[model samples]
Target: MKFPNPHYPNLRYPNRRYWYVPILSALLLLLNGGVNLALMRPLTDVPASMDKLRFHLDDAVFSLFFLLAAAVFAGAFSVLRRERGYLYLSFFSLMASQQFFWEWDGKHLLFGDFPVLPAESLAVKSGMTFAAFLFFRYLQGTNRRLTDRIFIYSAGGVWAMSVISSISPLASPLLPFLSGALLAIVLAYLLLAAGRFAHRFRRYPEDSELRLIVNGFAVFAILILPDVGKDVLQVLTGQRLGYLPVFWEACLEDTFPWALMQLIFVFGLLFFRRYMRVLEQNREAHAEIRTQHESLKQEVAIRQHMDRLLDALSGSYRLKDLEHTLVAEGRRLFEPHSFHWIPYNRKARSIDNSIDNPGLDSGELRELEELLFAADHGLVPGEILPGSKFAPVFIGVMGREELYAAISPKGRPLLERERFALQLLAKYGALFLDYYAMMEKRISELERYHGEQPWVGKLFMQMAEKERKRLASDLHDEVLQELLAARRWLEGSGSADDPMPAPERMRLALDNAEFMIRETCAELMPSFLSEHGVIHAVLKLADKMRVRADFQLEVRTGTLAAKLDDDLSLTVYRIVQELLNNAWKHSGAARVGLDMDQEAGEIVIRYADDGKGMDAEAAGMSPDRFGLRGLNERVRLMGGSASIDTRPDEGFRAECRLPLKRTATAPA
Candidate 1:
């Protein structure tokens, strides 16, 4: 027996080409009928026994029928190892084999009476009937719920009528006719189911598996008519002798089996092909999953390292630690070569920050300075100079003229995340030195005023403000750009099979990040302050608070005074900021007002809010809260005095007086 070919997963099969399989099967059926009739014409005088022995065509053809059934079973098993479609097909092959043996017994020897057992023959016929029913039941489209019920009822009606006929001889004649009608009904419905299957997959004509199924069933329906109707046709035209019809009669039984076998073969191929496709898809899916999982792991590790580094950089601020911390952070971020401070003394090879390296010899140091300065660092340190060999970023101070240290990253254009982190270190490095800005030119003033830990707290808060600004800038440049690019890729070119559903959600997240960064940057350093000085900064802060706190704020800063220095300007802004927070949080103020002016070469800032008040003396003892105590501490550090006046029923008021020593040439 032959078997259907095992499907090659890579082999392409076009459904359009497979339409020929059914067409050829139909043509062969007609050809078989015509040939049999022509051959039988000249053998009218020979006995049926002699006719069988003389021409082996009928014998050879029946043998092929058995092979075709085997092929069909093989094909069904190829698709799914456990699918019942193959099990049902096994039954069909058995029936075909039984029929072949029945023919063999009849034609065993000349004039031989080699009859099959009555019970065995009856069993084979019954088995074939059930197998055909199951074939219709299990195929994809024919197995629909409503369709299965119809098949069951139709088979049941045929069975009940046959049993009734067996119990009474008088009704036995109608049994054959009833069985024929039921068979016709079953075949008709099978054709309808096949047609519906084809219709459903019409748009997907390249699907060869589905095409084979539809076309194979169509061939079965086409051959079933002539094969089942031959007896009726012969009886109805019994007296009319026609050679062509007679030969066709001789061929019907032979031709129908071939058509049926061919249909089964097609079905087997379809199933096998479907199974191969499933395996390929599973492999591809697994590969994709592994790639995504590895990528996720790497991202998690990078983020953890970044978080740890950022925490370390933001928290530490000692003057001695700044140079070392800045250089170390750069090396971690960019992996640069030879991180050492640029020396100050005329001929010392050792750098100013005390880290000695042979790479920066006196002559080499001068050459390095010239190269770094020309590379766009603008004479201040912490400038990253990208070099093809030995990328060196400067992080410590250089040149004797400048008192503060300079930090530099020596590398060729660090990665986006690395550059962002290094820039943060540089921004704070500059501000950390400014914590001892008084020691630079006015060391005497520091000795004159002592506010204890309050002075240290003010420096810490100032450094914190610098960090906030740096972080906001980094988010805007690095994270925001990447998110927008990712969004555009998803919108323009993402595949439909992608797991992430909506590009719009990424867009919404991007918009939210942008807004948050903008607000943070503005809060850290008001845009209006640098351009229009402290007056506008106060007005803008109040305008924003009016909307947020639902309060009214009035500011007055009209008096004779020179432009203030950055220290006094930031100090005044923070004083007013602290007072506003107290009024809104503690006082529950609906109306708050602030007034600032210089009196006796002094800067005065006084603010009051209409809200519930607290004891001024009691509030001063509260520690760690940036309130009245903090305001007074800030005032005392700048050689100034702070006063808070409040009562239970009346509003809240905070006043600060600081001597502003600034020349007209100073830039605020």
Candidate 2:
């Protein structure tokens, strides 16, 4: 009766123990059976006039026993299974058992001379009608109509009449009529239930449960028709219908069918139990499949968004175009109520206010700056600005040089997938921004170079001529004269010397010429750099500068320095050489520091000197200051950035960030 549900294995009955209900029902049935048996008398003792209607005592006893047993079991099943339909069947059986016990010869078997109370009979009939109504309602499955309301009111009237008749002897005569009315109402309800079930069975012929219920109700309604007819005849004629004798005779016609109906209902309950388990499992399987489907769809959507962001990164050529792409994609991804791309001014050290957006005003901009500053110059997630409706997600692009802020339109937090997409978009957008900045600087430099082509060409030719004359002068004055002197010494050494040995003089002369040639080549380019790498070359340059300027120089390099391209290595060496020369000649620095490292696919170089610095703008414009101009040109040609921070009486500092390119042998 309390079987475990496969879908919900932990399900338990209301009571932990299982034996009390059946035991209690058994005790009650035993007491009722004992009382009925004590009141029963032998068939021979019955009056001769009632012989035609009297049933065998043994047969009567067996029928009563069967009915009572069915009643007890039905009640126990109803309690254990928690089903209302079986409870109603139990009530019907108990009422039928009582009718069989007392209806012998229309009176109690042992008290034939005693007067009968019509109130008691009316009470019993009302209870039977109530039980029938509940059972039919359960079969109907929560659907109620006007007829049900009428049956309810009629049952209420009969109960009220029975109560009145028991309280006052004067109301006894009306009890018979009340009982007739209740019986008619019960009969009509039964017929209606049978008809409804029949219609349902016809429509759903494949449903075995409906077929069983339909047959049970039809048999019950047909068996009760004879009794309803007998009650009508007695009430209309004002005399009992001897044609349909009351007592065990009447029960004999209906008892077996009623018992069969009870069995049908019990079997139906078993079928319903199995059906519910299967239905629950099917529902769970469908729910699990739906969850998996949703997960797969979300994964595909995230991948598509990433692909689109990658395309935008490669396709956009200008900062404005990239900004538009970011705003459009943000709206599609987040469906934000407001989106803005706020640019930051590095020189001003604040957000740019010249460009205006709808949602962010000057006050909001200041608050956003404060928030970024409070977050240690990094972006904060889901931060609410002053007077904003929802917390907006802020993404810092290109190291906070630009910001993308979006607020969800639904005024809720972003999902994890949406947040991840936004982060990726910000990262790719930063790369495009860096690319566009480099392109703009290159284009501007090209335009300036084109404008000054005539002057620059002539200046370069003059410098080349001046450099060639200087090289010739150094060769003539040092290497050329030394070689000629060495040749003369060798020629003269063939003859005898007057005071010193010719071999020692010739070896000395040859060594001096070789030394002069090596010095000339070192001025052209350091041979140590091409042989050893940039790191060692820089160290050698630092050693020479340290002694020449009498200043302490510190140099640091990372592992990435070993992977630099030959061209890039030379560029680095030249930039370091020029910076040191500038510091020694102009800054007169006491101490200098140089740092080389790699970050985010770029080689970073930082140089500083503790010396009296110059006005950077003024020094750049000076015609004689080719060292600073050439340093800027070298960085610019390599698609790198160089920034110098110096003022009069302050230390000079220069930082250069050069993008690393992938080589066949080295990873980028």
Candidate 3:
């Protein structure tokens, strides 16, 4: 609801009782009551003229009171803004206007001397009483449809009787009876109102204001009904109850109207006080409800924004795409000037510097990094470091490692709520970045693996070919020469055309060729691998490593399957051989452990060494490190994934999972 004032949140009214208003109203009523007694009782010899004694002491008091009541009701009509108020105003104004006419004639004012006839006095009473009937029902909040029909018809009949009496003297006898009937209707309505208030008083017994209002109404009804009964009795019986009758008339004239005014004044003041207090309370309640509604709207928007951000981040593998999305969404809320990124490692730079911040140079970015590292305060606002352009910075971390961002907002600093949102975004952004980086690294490694597949294949084939050619050269140059010489010696011993040769020399040349052929067979393909399985071959290599390299090699094969395929076994042998070669050449420590397991159609190998490990990025797949690169290629060719974790001081650990289960045919 719109308030009484649009800007002010609450309404203030003069609700505290104006105690003197009712007291003054009562005093005026008593003064008028005194005037009524003086005018009616002391003037026993007064003329009973049709147009005399209208203006007198009672007339002057009536005018003063009517004028005051009219003023009060008119103000009430303005403030109450109810039709019931209008009804009271109409009644009071009619009474006041009638009394004013009684004090003033057509041309001049008359006080204490104006004249009145019985018919004229009766007409005035008829109008004032009609207004009172309407006011009484309206003030009680009664159902007025039936009452309206009854009162209107009754008043009309009374007036009709009065009109007939004015036209013909014969109808004058019925006037008192009609007046008594009208007064009876008013009295009945007052009794009904009193009964309703009494029922409410019983329902809410502790309500002090209600109790006061009910008491006033009860007092008014009791006092006013006595006047109605006395007047009705005189009209019906034509027998005046003369003893103590004047005492009753004086009490009716003085106390009757005063009781009615007392109830009306108290009820009105009390009702207005409660109404204003309720209005103020409603104003506060509506304000709180609106504030809560606004907060709920903000929270919903924040949740939707977070959902959108997560959607953008889910599939974003590149840092640049993620950066662009961050800028766009951050612009929606914060409108920062630019978004800059820096790496924890000073060497690695921002993914998008030229696009996000065109003029910012690398030197400034490094300085920002320095300032962040040197900042003493935590992540609350107003914790700016000296010589820092960023007023608020949100740091992101992954595990123990820290990542960086300059985050120089364009204009003013972020609000506390915005900073909190940014911190949330930054944390999730860092986590997603780590995930994307891992994926990007794997993709690059697979690319390098594929690219090197053919080259690694060619290099191994070239080495095998070179080894075979060297064996062929040795057999041709030395073994063939010895055999030819032994043949010549045999030919010389057999005939005169052959050169001189002994039987012992021929036997020695044959022995030398046999030994050279055995050495070539061993170099080309070890016979031990063909005779034994992959496990035996690996244990043999460990034995050789223990005897020759002084390395403690422990091997576990509890989960390894028996009877590996020829190709698989060859691949495993080469892998173990290359691992040992790298461990012996690069690693200076003496301990190595290898665990081989084949479970549920997959081959898993875990190799670890307590050795001086090398830089992982530098040594894993570098050009010079052909051993690890070749081992990775061999695993890739078998359709597998390989990972090597190494640090400078920590031990090197390598794991390879290869799908090498053989059924009808080996996997391509």
Candidate 4:
């Protein structure tokens, strides 16, 4: 019996191809770099009128463009790879891009070109503040609903701030202070995000990706801190500081720091792709393991169910009991909506519907009978009947007799293990039915003859007790006397020059004592009966009888004689021994014929002799005269019949039929 392996329908992992995303991002980055280089002027060719401060300002503008392009590429990679950290990185890049554009316009202001409007400056600052709030909120892992509410409230607040700063004359003076305050808030949020990432890295020390994120956040925060400090100083004093040189101020305050932050973010994004791939692989491996574990558990449960069903069925001895057990076990295993037994009536040549369940309608019952008749032996797969909601399975119990079951409409179809269990149930059911039929017939026969026969139990008990006393007396008188005489002879004075040696005399006495003991044991329970069964014991009995009596004995037996159980074999052997003894001692028979055979589930024994016969009527009236009454009682006790045929001057003939209780070796 092989069980099929369980399959998981939803465990399939798609083979998604993501190899081309990095290749496309790299090509776009190169093209953007080439265009920036083509637009920029040479630094060494600046005119003498242009001071070092102006020259550094032009160089800073070129670097800001490069930094902007890099930030865009990193944001694109984060989006394409679908990293969890992409939201924070994207919003922060937008905030930085707005700040850089404001600085480029400020550089034009330094040369007295006032093309930028005050309203436009306030609007860009408001946009930068909004992007910073969103970036901080997402970094803290806020829920979607709360994040959406924050976005709405912040957008309204920043819009109102921009409108007030543009329309009110007093608000224009406070705009620089407001911008500095916003930059300080953004710097504080960047540090908070870095601290959070650092705490996470400590919690999961094995995750190198978390450590890399913590380092990236810390680096970006440190680079932007100086610019925030410079803005704070300018807002407090209400005047630009002239302590640092122009070149250092342009490079350290904004351009150099922002470019380095963008570069670090781009490299981190590339490493994140590899880390996400590893995480996906781990998830797939864990899912496969869980699936296999579930499959193994199901297999063990199926094996246990089979063992439990077999144990229950093996103990059943009657047809009704077996049917009930099958139904109970089937219900537990299959959870069927309905279950029943359909018995075949051999005499009527049809199904016996009289004892069927009342729940079954006429149409369903008739369809079941038809299916049982049409189906072959063993398990028949389920099929839907004409008016049935569920398919019914027909399992043959014996010949045309079957067990019927219908699964529930919503239940799944039978699995391989369940079908195997049904097949096993059918086989055991058939065997139990056959054995039950034999026992039932034996019981009925006993009931018919029970009233006519004398009570054999008390009689047999009394005879057994008397036989034991006789055996004890024989051992004490014969064997004990021989051993005592031998012991006395060895102790007494020996005569010299005797014909027989003294040791020989003692050995002879011991041999006789041993033989007497063996003979007594044989009479109580023959060795051949226990060793070989009834047929061999009968042959040995005849051989011994031939040596003791003047009659010739002939014995014949069949193959089934070897298959009888120990109790039945012993009883049959005793019957044959008794009949042979009676014929030798009372009938004065010259020859005897003992025949044994099996037919119609019974053992038949026949005995005949050529000797003077007595009157049949006289022997029936006085059964104890030749121990004939005891013999008849023995046969009756075994649910059998015995008869003797005799007449004056004719041979005696007797026949007995005993019920056969077969052993494991018996044919099915």
lDDT of each: 0.60, 0.63, 0.62, 0.60
TM-score, cand. 4 vs. native = 0.35
Per-residue lDDT for 1-668 in model 2, tens only? Answer: 11112224333222123243345333333443443343342357767545433433433554476477557657665645645555676776666555555454534444456556557667766866776676666556533667777786788678778868967899988876887788688778767866776676576565545545444444544444555677778889999754334334434233333444444454445435544654676699899999889877987886777688778767878767877887777666665545556666444568666655556666777766655444434554333343433233444455446465544335665565665565666666655666777777777876777676666665555546645765797689877877777687677744554465776767777788797688567646767666887788888778877776777889898867447777687778878877887777788788889998888888888999889988877555455666666677667767787988888888899998877874222101
Per-residue lDDT tens digits for candidate 4, residues 1-668, read: 00000111122222333343344334333433343343332456765335434533534565465456547656655655543334444554554555555556335535566444455565655665565455445434443555345554655465467668767667677677666655555556556555655676566554434444444444454555666687789989999864233333433444233434544454445335555565687798899999888867766776676677778877877666777876777666655444455565434446666654545677866666665455544444342233344345554445544445544333665555555555555555555566677777777766654654544444566566656765888799879988986896698654565577778888988998998898778868776676877787888788878887888888888877337776778778888988887777787887889999998889999999888888877558363443566677667767788988988779888999987753332110
- The candidate that wins on TM-score is 1
Provide TM-scores for the models.
Answer: 0.42, 0.33, 0.39, 0.35
Candidate 1 structure quality by residue, lDDT tens digits, 1-668: 00111233243455466567556765766777776766555577888766766554565456566656666676766756656667677777767766665655435664457643423443454456666777656655345578676766666566556555655667667656766766676677667665656565675566665556667766776776665576567778886333344754655655566666666666666655655666786798899899888867756755665566556655765555655665565455445534444434424432354554434456655555555445542545445565523234434443352322222335554344554445555555555555444344354534444333356556457546645655766676756775776676566665557576556656665776676677657666666565778877777777766765667777787754577767777888878876776666577777888888878899888888888776655656444343555567667767887877778768877778888864322110
lDDT winner among the candidates?
Answer: 2
Worst 10 residues of 3 by lDDT: 1-10
Worst 10 residues of 2 by lDDT: 1-10
Worst 10 residues of 4 by lDDT: 1-10
Model 4, CA-based lDDT: 0.60
TM-score of 1: 0.42
lDDT of 3 at 177: 86
Say which prediction, candidate 1 or candidate 3, comes out ahead on TM-score. Answer: 1
What lDDT score goes with residue 540 in model 3?
75
- Predicted candidate 3: what Cα RMSD to the true structure? 22.7
